[model samples]
Target chain A: MKHTLSVLVQNKPGVLARTAGLFSRRGYNIESLTVGVTENENVSRMTIVVTGDDTVVEQVTKQLNKLIEVIKVSDLTKESYVDRELVLIKVTADGSNRGEIMQLVDVFRARIVDVAAKSLIVEVTGDEEKIVALIAMLKQFGIKEIVRTGTLALGRGPKVIQSGKD
Target chain B: MNLTGAKALIKSLEYEHVDTIFGIPGGVVIPIYDELYQQDAITHYLVRHEQAAAHAADGYARATGKVGVCMATSGPGATNLVTGIATAYMDSVPMIAITGQVTTDLIGNDAFQEANITGITQPVTKHNYLLHDASEIPQTIKEAFHIASTGRPGPVLIDIPKDVQTMTAPFDYPKKVHLPGYQPTYEGHPGQIKRAAKAISEAHRPVIYVGGGVKISGASEEVRALAETILAPVTMTLMGMGTMPADHPLSLGMLGMHGTRYANYAVTESDLIIAIGARFDDRVTGKIASFAPNAKIIHIDIDPAEIGKNVRVDIPIVGDVKRVLQKLMPMLKQTRTKEWMEKVHTWKREYPLEFEVTGLRPQYVVREISRLCPDAVVCTEVGQHQMWAAQYFSHRHPRNFISSGGLGTMGYGFPASIGAKIGRPDETVFDLAGDGSFTMNCQELATAVAYDVQVKVAIFNNGYLGMVRQWQELFYDRRYSQTKLSEINFVKLADAFGAHGIRVDSASEVAPAIKEALAVPKPVIIDFRIEPEECVWPMVPAGAALNEIIDAKSGKV
Candidate 1:
């Protein structure tokens, strides 16, 4: 199974390499990973997508927490919180198919970021469900390129919660 | 805070008095490497392989009684350091492995090159770091070094992402660190120390069983002082070599399957056994129920978990070996037991380190190396030569003999010797290896060549995995069972990696090979072929008591 995890850590040199090194050495297939600053400057949050046994992900979480740099790790797939992913999709949309693509884009509320001779880049933001639906609708137009921010999550009904700092 | 991370690392090392680091360059690690480069305060060496870098760092840590640091890039570069990290972890050498990571956004998008290195190294490392923010670097680094160098010291992995590296953070190197759950006991409790001293002072015959912790914690002098004060015989674990002079009057050599006769005799007859820094591994205490049968065992160690791990402890002194000895010294009454000393002397005279010189001898190779390097720090890979070095080398100082004693890891000698050399650069470092054991990690020769760290490797080139072969020959009715090994040309292999290499087939050439190898001031490998049947003598048959050593096939016992 593939699982996406959000981890908060003390941003510093060597932290990324050590985290990545762990997955590879253990032969865990890392499907995707994204790390960026959180609301707080001291903590940088990572969105990691990995394919492994259910048990392996939990083991990885425990091990990740053991690192001095890692403040906390949450298996977002199992957590009840607000999470969103932003994906930019470049689809086939020239004069011949422009009208049909625009109607579909309007329904999804996705914006056209860039327009080329035969392709239009559509920016869509939602959870995995909305993004997957948008990608499926654009499949007929052909997907020239696709880029995603993976998933960043925040626990619901928070009081300015520090995800793993507690 | 940059100061916090850097200072934490430096402060933890200062506790160990570490003076050096070995690493290389990369994008993510620039922040750290830059800090180190600008600091003339701590010496940093640039080595070739990230793997070599880590091993060299481990060598420095083990040799110097300090924590060693090595750095590398993200993805493959960081992954390359895994083998060396595992090496240090297996051998219990304190090392901190640092690697760079991709910027935050590139982390999970399959963007560019990035790997989850901390997860990869978790099993092998004592602790690790995956710093998400730039500010926590110092505190994490300090924690890494602290966890690595304390208790059963092992490797710690720290991964720093690129963005965090570039982020501006207040760099305040800490002079002290506050780790809530990480208190290490350095002094044995006063009550336990007094009880132990009373036992030693009251015993009719006493024995001190010393192990690697003695050498690691620099308690040899204190151990010897305590032993002499109590007038007890000393038997060293393989790791305990150099805990006290092997040739000391009270020293009874090594104790185990192939331990010296005097060491086993003292173990068998003693009324009180003082085990300091030594874990009672199965190899040392063959049949636990029968080991030191007549003795009341007093166990002293820094790790509370190890106090009663194997053998039951009559008195457990939970503290550092040196501090425990210091406290116990004043509490004990000094004595000169002439009769017990006389018996141990007799055992030494009878079953000496005597082997027939007619055939190719592993002991001869070790003896020659020891002859040239009276003060050399000897490390060994696990096998026949490991036992030989433990027996043949006359270790006079503490922390001079580094080997994988507890775990008995095979590829230990090569890298551990590198660590020992880095620890004590003034003293020559020699890795005494069996052919089978040497081949396990001979790739580390590149580490030596990269840093120009001089380490001499004397390969006891037996055609088989000598230790396993001996067990099969003696107990399994010569069912080799894949113990037979392939031929490896040591000179060619070492030369392939840009190291000085030689093959010595004659006994007379032993001294010359070691002397020439030592003179080059670079890593050198010397291979010595010996008869396959050659065994480390005073062999205790499997499942037998300590004193029940076979001595040899013909029954010298």
Candidate 2:
């Protein structure tokens, strides 16, 4: 089964590499990982989607807690949380396809943020599944370019997660 | 006290009383090395290769019972130490490896010689880190050292980028580390200790199956004392070779595959087996169900995972061996079992390790070498000869013999002996190796010569990868395949490094050749060309019990 782990780490040069390195070294397949600074200036939250057995995930959590830079890790799949991903899809937008694409974007609650003479840029913000669905639809218009912020997560309420809090 | 992270790191090491640091300097690691320079605490040994530095550090740690330290730069330098770190990890050597990383900004840009070292080393190390704040450096170093040296000791890496290392920070070195997940139990429970004593007093045929725990727990003396007081025969796993003096009445040589005839008999016949500090590796215990079938086993280890990893424990003591032994020593009763002693003695006489030496037997040469240099530290690489030395050599003290037992690493002997010699300068050290095993790390002969370390190397040259050849002869229908190795004159190879060398083709030449080398004031090599098809006998084939050893002397299984 696939699970998304959102890790809050001290913002440092090697922290992300260390995270990626841990996954690869332990033979944990990281399908996708996105990291960026949090509202807190000193901390960076990274969302990583990985597939493994329950035991392996537990081992991974314990191992991650052992690293000094990692401040916290939460298996967001277990929590009442929100995971979001943003993707900018640039598709050819000649007069023929622009109107039809804009109608589909409205139906999906996404917006066409940029438009040039030959292409249109669609900005979509949703969970990974929603983003993936929009990306697949835009591919029909002959997508010229695409970039995705993999996944970002936040826990519900006032609850805070700490690494090795146990 | 105000101190740099580097200074705090050195001070923490000083608290641990680390005597030496092995590493190569680089820009990223210079700040730490500078702090190392400021202290008169631990002397640093500049090794040519980072990998060698790591291995040397491991060797020093394994030999001296102290935490070994090594440092290197980020990227390739840190990557080079991977094999050495893995070697230590696999063998359970305590080590702290520090690496310098690219500065804060350049870290992820794939800048000049910069790579994520903590990430790279994460899986290989028992624990690892990437330092973000300079203030956390001192505590991280302490935590790394704590994790590395405590419980079942293993390697840990701390990667500090150049920016973090140089950044001035208030370093408060904590005396005690408080990691709930990492607290290692170092003493057995009182109830378990009492049960162990009860089993010992009640056992009709008791035997102590000792392993590396005796050394790692620093319990060799305690184990010896307990064995003597209880009057139980002791058999050691290969890793436990030097835990008890070989000449002691309680010592039953080594007890496993290719173990001595008597030692295997004792283990098989014993009703109660007390195993300490030895994990039940497949090589040591064949067919787990049938091993020590009639015996009740009491296993003690620091790591809880290892308790039931192999065999079901009848009484498990999860703690450090030394501390457990100390706790149990008071509970042990004064007793003697003359019947158990005599029964084992009968097995010894009936089935002694004997081979006719009409010509040059490697067994005879090992015995001769031991007799000539009884006090010299004898180290062996894993194989038939390693087993041969274990069977033949009369070790007079604990911690005097060293070899790669847990991992069964081939290239460990030469470097391990060099490290051992450096620690114990008063004693001459010899690394007894097969030609194949010798060549695995023969490059280290230069290390010996360069360090002005005269570690005597004795190679049993059989013109093949001797161990595999023995198996092929016995089991593979004599299909040699690639087991026949290259014919390299190792003596000439030793000479090319500006060292002394000798070759012994005859049995009579063995003693005189060693005498000549021992007389010389420099390191020397002696290659003994023995019978090629000779196999280490009293062999328990894979998937056989200790009692089922193949006795080649009788030409029968």
Best-performing candidate as measured by lDDT = 2
Docking class of 1: incorrect
lDDT of 1 by residue, B29-128 (tens): 6666666656566777665556667766766666677778777888888998887788777567788887888887788765555888877777688777
Show model 1 residue runs off by greater than 4 Å. Answer: A1-166, B1-19, B23-51, B74-92, B102-117, B150-152, B494-498, B520-522, B541-543, B554-557
Instruction: Mark the 10 consecutive residues where model 1 chain B has the least summed lDDT.
Output: B1-10
Tell me how each candidate scores on DockQ against the true complex: 0.05, 0.11
Model 2's chain A TM-score stands at 0.89
Model 2 chain B scores worst on lDDT over the 10 consecutive residues at B548-557
lDDT of 1 by residue, A102-157 (tens): 88988998888888899999999988788889999999999988998877766566
CAPRI docking class of candidate 2: incorrect
Task: Please name the candidate that would achieve the greatest DockQ relative to the true structure.
Answer: 2
CA lDDT of every candidate: 0.78, 0.81
Candidate 2 Cα misplacement greater than 4 A, ranges: A1-166, B1-16, B26-41, B108-117, B334-336, B553-557
Q: Indicate the DockQ of the complex predicted as candidate 2.
A: 0.11
Indicate which candidate wins on TM-score. 2
B413-448 per-residue lDDT for model 2 (tens digits): 877787777777778888899988888778777877
